[model samples]
Target: MTAFNPITISCFKAYDVRGELDVNLDNAIAYRIGRAFAQYLNDGKENPVIVVGSDIRPSSESLKQSAIDGITDAGIDVIDLGMVGTEEVYFATSHYNAIGGIEVTASHNPINYNGLKMVRENSRPISGDTGLADIRAIAERGEFVVADKGRVTLNTDKTAYIDKLMSFTDTTKFTPKKIVVNSGNGSAGPVVDELQKRLGDNIELIKVHHTPDGSFPNGIPNPMIIANQKATSDAVIAHGADFGVAFDGDFDRCFLFDEKGRFIEGSYIVGMLAEVFLKKHQGESIVYDPRVIYNTENVIAQNGGTPAISKSGHSFIKQVMRETRAIYGGEMSAHHYFRDFAYCDSGMIVWLLVIELLSVTGKTLSELVNGHINDFPSSGELNFRLGQKTASEISELLEQKYHSSNPAKNTLDGLSLDFGNWRFNLRSSNTEPLIRLNIETKGDKALLKTKTDEILAVLDECGAVSADH
Candidate 1:
């Protein structure tokens, strides 16, 4: 008699699989995940192929190899795209007409961690409710149907993916400009180099930390961290560049800095991208998350476009984009999605579109976003680590206190209260043990500060410590 041993995998999250290496994930787990994913997505299709890729993490190569072995063992052909960004897998899945794809990357997580982002045919996201849960169940069960092993092939071509990016705008219109690009020693360097060749001599790129280093000597490539942003910001100022762009580990999110080396909040970037897209495709719907609304809402309305709101997350945004047929969708967290890009988010596309907007309009990055920033002063996202108190308890307390003010409310993704001129959104982090807060007001810098402080006081009362501290 064979014994059945049930294994528990804690890496599977609401949207993707992320875990601490050797703890929640390893080569064994990666292999099982790949086998399960192939089984779940095959759907009796013949010659089923799965595209696989990995980032620059030291552990990613072996993990990817194990995944490929498992997929091929399950009679699924594998296309190995060695050491690429997450979006590249998305591109390959749709571009090659594969059954599905997986990218072995932990993104901006700590070095001890690694994870995987997956998508089905046509690059459709496989979230928890989609196919991730089934994959998780299969992986946990550790059961597989026997079949003839398949073959593996290598595909390192980025030409098609780069071509698709260039299709977003007219390259001939790119004016001569010096730009600072910091890849944060992650997977973005190779792609940036490819872009430089296509960009020609008209645009000078001042590259910083533009190498793939697994050690992450310059820190984890997370531009959202204030400390990690200095390298990009300082390079921009030192080189006297027009603007600067920084990316995370997998390069799925790109953060921007103005000529003055001032970090531009993601919400403001969302508003600017919304306006850019609307101008090109008039009356098209633009989807945005519920984190900060006034700036994005105003921009969409003024540009003759409808604003579609969705919960904050890649899966939610992509689903909303498809349902609304939105031309572009962006989150204040620096994720930007395009309809043409198989509804997948790409940091590369975001910068390309921004550069095109800059050249065609003959406007500086600041010149374009300054008005929106002034009109809708925002508190930028604030993170708080809770102590004893739960997010719900804190939210309920805030609601009870402000209920008498008659502020309009919405619970789309979290607790959002709009008091006519001022609004705020408080939600727990989807990926971390923290709570996020964003505040915005109508053209009132002083009010923005006042309200921001007011909210901080309330959070402090709830024993929530600022993540910054």
Candidate 2:
């Protein structure tokens, strides 16, 4: 038996486990996490089963196998769903009646990093506040219960998962449209190929960097970064496609590009999706993040859908979606969740629904979102690298400065200050050392710019911005 090596618990984050490979995270740590997760899910029951999946990262297979070994060692049956996106693990967990699921993926991280996303039965997330802390503590302890090893089985049938994703909208209503899909050489290719095969003549799917390459020769599939978006935008322009879609490494979050080769902000997409859902199911609830709110609120109100605000993260969005029974939930970060799909976010399903909306409306992507963009012009999310002061400290100072006006404020996830005509949200990133800022003004582009600059000045005063910049 290989002696277990004790490792630091830093890889376990607020939402999922992620870190640089072989440094803060490695196969040894993965094994321990598997064992710990199994112990957590056992719940005084026998024959607890776990579904395991991995992305296309070079190190994912080795880490997955080691984790499986630890899980089986704890007498938990393992259903191996090989080489899949993170959402597939969530689907499999619910489909197979497993006690829990784990996806070995460092989603959208650099090539040198790898990690895991875990969930409990019914595809409910295991975040730090829920059960990740306990798993971290147990894994750090390195103690295991002696039990007979369990069985491991392999299953890669994604037919049901694909069918379920398509069930959100009627295919008969889909009109043929040429669209570009840039997989960014990540784990999304296989799933896209499968869905494309099912769609047949309904869409002209233009593929770019569609192969699943762990080396990420192009780059990691983070479309949020402006530099990383050129490929999708260029492809859309070159192909004259209706629109372009890009996915992260694990295909759980997706971004959009318009027919004119312009990157569309996720906030506008949220408003459009809310309208789509509400047109069919009026008075239903729609959940949105507090980052940029005017467009979503206006669209939901006009479409007769109740708007609910939630913290901006996959776990929080999914939890709030379930609590509010929201038909759809979207965040400016491009994570879209649906109540129909076990309240979990899925990149594949997002694009499919977008296609359905485009077909039903007979409008280009730009046309679909332009009205909202005009109504709620926004300064896209800006990140300030902190130097001396913490995000909370800066937030407090800004709050003091604006409190004299007695603006509507909420601290649900961060500092959301609504000044009637214009508003901004200042929040610290869950995984990084930067403070993110999002500002929006009602139909006033000039005010948007002025207020954005004003906020930057405030950040400078608060030492949230580095002095060198």
Candidate 3:
């Protein structure tokens, strides 16, 4: 008998199921998860159908097929939406009225990785307590208890998804603007290629590394990495286009760059997107993650819309958006979810809106987004491994020390403390065994450093390093 790794059997996490491909997320485990998910959602129904989608990663096909077989074996039907992003799965599930959906994607991870994110009815996400842990536990046991097997179906080429995205906004107003898009060579290539062909040369899009190369030749599809953004920024400057846009592996999170070759931090993108969405549909509420500065709230409010601050996870943001009927939601991590897209995030949709924003505003990308260079400097999303420590342990100690006494502290996501005029959030990673921290403060750059140092000192006491883990 071969030895089994616990990480593989126990890796389905709070937000979704993720780990390295082949090692933790192999076909056998995917098969079991499919069966387990079908059983869990069906509750002994006649025939529960699920919509399955996968990105363009090489291994996605095999894993998705195995999951489909597992679900079918458990007497559930699978509607395969092949080669689509996560948002498309959400759309198919909701549109077709399936029990739930599964999207096989690793969103922004390195080339050697892959995983899955699941949702129950109404496109609601399945997380740790919500159901991921149970699914992982069932898959690990690897025992089959099914009397009748289900069926598997296929539906590729998401024409409706693409059309719906285009219909959500009035592109005519935003046309005639030359924009640059670099999709980081993930699953976004086909979608971007089609969009460029449809939009024609009038947009002057500079598509770089937008092909479906699972090898990730142009560095992983993550645009947030300074290393990955180099090509996009250079292309923007070289082509003399207005700005640049890049997508992650599954094209869910988008990062931006100005014509002057400056990376606009994602917090600004969240705020800018919020403003644009509110302007289009007057008084629509916007959802925002708690990691970045609350400037998003101010921007949405100033734009005559309500701003609802939610936790940092995509699932949390989507839930908040659905509950509040928010027009749009954005996290500082570059994930932007939309209610119009069945409460799922889409990097392509976000970039499309930004293009319209530029055309309608008639201002340079820098001019429109520069004013929001984060009045409060922040250390975006910093991850620190906690060997034997959990966020709860550190959070308990710090609450009384800083937050409880301050009385103005916020625990909406994790622990957000406001010391005088500065603020920061010390939270746990939704998917990893790491302690995540974010520090933001007013225009005073020195104060930002001091606050960050203070938090770091406390985290160090709990055996966390200041360096990225």
Candidate 4:
């Protein structure tokens, strides 16, 4: 048993618990967290039943066991859904009528990283504002009371989860197409294999790094980084595939590449999906993040659906979706949430819906997104490392510089300065000490480049270092 020392709060992030392993988060911390989470949900009348799942990270299994031990020690029953994606835990929590769920995963973080994502009833996340702060405090205190232990049951089957994912689309309407599915040796393999078993006849899947290996043999399973996409792009071109899809470590977020091996930004995909959902629902609300909005707003409005903007984050997006009763919600970072799926982000459902859109429209993935791309040429998210200036300092400088222009500033998630022809969002990352910048222009690639350069100059002047270093 690991000793009970106070764990650093660095692991308790805005949305979930995540940090470098051993340094801040470990089996001991996991166990303490489990006890704290159980105590939080336990009302004394009955023991809370909690669902637990884990990703393919090497440290995840032990951490999961420690958590389960702590929960059981607190007289909380646990159901272990072994080696599953984060969404599966969310699904299992609501599907089984459990009080809550916890998924052990680092989710696209470095191999040395690991963490937990917790949710309450109805798959609602437990973030800082919700329950994470309390949980963190309990864990750090390490003053858990001993009680009659509860039992744990192993139920590793993913059939129900896959069925739920398949329910989002019509398999009969799926046109036969050869595509590359890159799991990047993450937890996506088993789920993707199950999905293939259901639709193998219609979809020709070219598997790349399809095996689940916690070692992350394919360089971190994060396709958001341009270099990390090389394997998927190469496989797509080599196999003459229709398109390529890549999943993160926990398979909660997915990224896309075109048949031509060009990466498609997530903002355009959000717009495409808005149009798709609007066609079916006709007038349902669609939730989107405020970072890049023109394309999504335009498409949602044109398609007779309302576009609601929310602060960027899974917890924030899900809450907004529930409040607005939105049918769909998406972020530019590739997290897509569906109302049918308990408002939880699923990496599988988004790609499947895109495939369905492609089949119905008889258009290539590039064709589907090119119009939005041309309409809203954007500088994909650019991260600048903090130097002498802090994130707040840099943001203040940008606001001061642009304040006089009166370019329709919005301080929702960050500072969004909107000009008639071009706009930019400059926000500090919630998880990292870096400033994120996004610039987009209406039908003007030149304006996008010019504005991007102008922002880069400002960032440079504000003591920000390029991420390239």
- What TM-score, over all chains together, does every model reach? 0.98, 0.96, 0.89, 0.97
lDDT by residue for model 2 (1-469), tens: 3335555688888889988987899888898999999988887556678999999999999999999998998889999999999999989999888999999998887789899999999999999989999999888888778778989999988899998988886778889888999898988998888888878686899999999999999988888888889999999999899899999999899899989999999999899889888989999999999999999999998999998899888888888888899999999988888888888888888888888888888889999888889989998888878867778888888888888989899899789999999999989888766789999999999999988888899788766763212
lDDT of 3 by residue, 275-361 (tens): 877777879888888777667867877899987888888878887898899988888888888887788887778777777777777
- Compose the digit string of candidate 4's lDDT tens values, residues 215-324: 98778888888888889999889999889999998888989988898889999889888888899899999999989999999999899998799999999999999999
Deviation of model 3 at 148, angstroms = 4.4
lDDT of each: 0.92, 0.89, 0.78, 0.89
Show pairs that collide, candidate 4. Answer: none
Question: Which regions of candidate 3 fall more than 4 Å away from where they truly are?
Answer: 1-8, 43-47, 141-148, 387-407, 453-463, 466-469
Show where candidate 1 strays beyond 4 Å. 1-4
Model 2 worst lDDT window (10 residues): 460-469
Error of 2 at 329 (Å): 0.9
> What are the RMSD figures for all models against the true structure?
1.3, 2.1, 3.6, 1.9
Whole-structure CA lDDT of model 3: 0.78
| Best candidate, TM-score | 1
**Model 3 TM-score (2 dp):** 0.89
Over 1-469, each residue of candidate 1 has an lDDT whose tens digit, in order, gives 1112669999998899999999999999998899889888988886789999999999999999999987987789999999999999999999999999999999999999999899999999999999899999988888886778988999998999999988887788889888899998999999999998898778899999998999999889888888988998899889899899999999999899998899999999999989888988999999999999898999898999998999999999999999999999999999999999999999998887777888888989999889989999998899999987899999999899898999999999889999999999999888888999999999999999998998899899889998853
What range of 10 consecutive residues in model 4 has the weakest lDDT sum? 1-10
Give every collision pair in model 3: 72-150, 189-210
